[model samples]
Target: MNRKVIVTCALTGAGDTTGKSGHVPVTPDQIAADAIAAARAGASVVHIHVRDVETGQGSRDTALYREVVRQVAASDVDPVINLTAGMGGDLVIDPANPTVALEGTDLVSGLERLVHIEELRPEICTIDCGSLNFGEGSSLYVSTPDMLREGAARIRELGVKPEMEIFDTGNLWFANEMVAEGLIAAPPLYQLCMGIPYGAPVDAGLLQAMVNMLPEGAQWTSFAIGRNQMPWVAQSILLGGHVRVGLEDNLYLSKGVLATNAQLTERAITIVESMGASVATPDEAREILKLDKVA
Candidate 1:
């Protein structure tokens, strides 16, 4: 096996992990610092999602994204920046009314979601492939087929590579359809988002099934949330796929132990090396992902 695996460190995600983890970076400075540190530690790419500093909740404000991108780009450490365009599509419908959305519903147009990507023009951005029941509750992430096509088109126009995020088999199917429709560029980059509630399970069989759904010549990575994060690093690389890790997907280095983003990335590198796979450098990752050089 050619032992070169790319490592993508997802910084603080949009999830509510602020009070849970002591190392989740809330402020722009902290997030940027952690990103740089993860790069130095061995991550070739850093996936970012900024949070409202005051509330530690995820925000789609372009200004906030600009600051995060600027800080990461201007820093001494250089890693390919991948901003998330998966926000602003969450829909929490009221069970009682069924017609009215709940207070937590945040629905924005596809164009509105890409505003930051337009301004920053980061080398890469995420385009969620399809929607799924996020959990057992009434919450459903609303990434309709039309929305996916629109977002993919806009990202392509902006010269940003779209990392198709697939959380289930249907999402993978939709991703293939997107490629067939010419919405996504050739050799589509995919991220198998496993272990999320109501999504694909973290078991090997499901992971392999999702991988088998990829189009020919596709470049892909796989990650699991929470406890499955670290283990999936080994699973992904072993399956001839790439790996992603960070505090965003997981908060613990071990049982009852909180981990920083850098620590999570370092652990991933260790796993790769242990399996006779070398961690790809930032430049190597750029070439593999076909990202523009870091500015």
Candidate 2:
């Protein structure tokens, strides 16, 4: 077992989960506070996704992202900032024609999706490595090869680490090739996203197979959704990788108890400690990640 692990708190996701739980951070201030609170609770990094305050839906606005980063910078805690560059790839199709793009479809060039990342230049950003039917609807998320190549190249120029988001085995295959082709930097970071709809199933065997396929010396983390969230913490650690947690992936501290970002992080700390491994601090995490400097 790896004695030291990095616990990243994905403070807010672009999911329609705000109505389901009051703890999900919506406003910029709330999102930054959640990141700081998670850091205090033992998370070395914080993954962020801004939401529209009025609609409580995901947004790719640079203004909202600026405010969130500003607030976190003002705070004493300096947890590594990870901005979600996974927006602007939604592809909702019209059932009748298949050729017509529906209302929810928000496809844009890969560079267009990186507007916020280009401006904020956070320490880390996410790039979904492949396209998939996002959920149980007409919605699909598109990230084609050409898009990935362009996005990865731009991210390299900005000197920010791109956390490759792999939703399935095929996505992993493509990610590995991106690294091989030098589109992604060496020691690429991969997020083994599990338990999402119509993608890779959240099972140990699948996780193991994905892990086995990883390029040598790759930095990796994994998480699952709903009740499986907490269990995957131990699973990731046992597999010699990091873990992520927060309102984005789960909302409950227990079956009936709702949880805050800090509470969820505190719980993750308990699991890591109980397994005889210590959690890494922010500075330690930067070193572990081989980051030359923190933004």
Candidate 3:
């Protein structure tokens, strides 16, 4: 329990949570402010996703990303920046015509999804491993095997560490296959996402099994949404992995208490410290994840 734990604060996700919690930052300035605060509060990394200023919904606009990164880069703190390349894969299918996509769909090519990543060139970007029923609807997050392969190879070529996002056992299996094919470079990094609908449930035994399935020398982190956020920090640490928390996954710090990004990160640090493990600094996290520090 004397290990150093890397704490990643996911500032804002592409989920429909902006209305649910006032703490969820929408504009670039707000997101950047939250990131700087979280880093000052002892988070090792900041996972970012920009939102449209007017609609308050998630956006893949490179301009929005540019603004957010610019603000954070100009800030005093220097937490490792981890951009979300998991956007542009959402496909909300039409009920009658399954072949035709619905309005909510933002489906695009795998390379298209990396447009922002290519421009920003952050230290870390995410590639969701496989497709899944995103939530309790006709929505399906599409990341086909071919798409994943193309994305991984591109990310590797760009010299950005790709965080293989494992939603379920199938995603993990495909990720291993990518490693075997030498698409993912040495010291691969993974994020074991749990408790999302139609994905891996929040079960310790299942998490242990997934951890066991990971290739040797792989660096991994895990997180669950809603009430499971705080508990999953200990769960990930106990299983020898890093942790992520923030408004993206959970709105409340406790029941009936809406929490900000900084608050969640502070609580995560407390948990890590209480368990006899120290929270990793940004540099320490870069070393652990084998990331090339952006200058």
Off by over 4 Å in 1: none
Give the clash total for candidate 1.
Answer: 0
lDDT of 1 by residue, 1-295 (tens): 3379989999999888899987999888888999999999989999999999899999898888888778877878888888999899888887898888887788898778898899889888998888888887799888888888888988888889999999989999999998999988766899999889988888999888887888888899999988888888989987889999998899999999999999999999999999998988888888777776635
User: Which candidate would rank higher by lDDT, 1 or 3?
Assistant: 3
TM-score of 2: 0.98
lDDT of 2 by residue, 107-221 (tens): 8999999999888898889999999998797899999999999999999999999999999999999999999999877679999999899888899999999999999999999
The digit string of per-residue lDDT tens for model 3 on 1-295 reads: 3389999999999889999988999999999999999999999999999999999988999999999999989999999999999999989988788999988999999999999999889999999999999878799999999899999999999999999999999999999999999999889999999999999999999999999999999999999999999999999999999999999999999999999999999999999999999999999998888889767
Task: Name the better of 1 and 3 by TM-score.
Answer: 3
Off by over 4 Å in 3: none
Which candidate wins on lDDT?
A: 3
Q: Cα RMSD (Å) per model? A: 1.1, 0.9, 0.9
Candidate 2 least-lDDT 10 residues = 286-295
Worst 10 residues of 1 by lDDT: 286-295
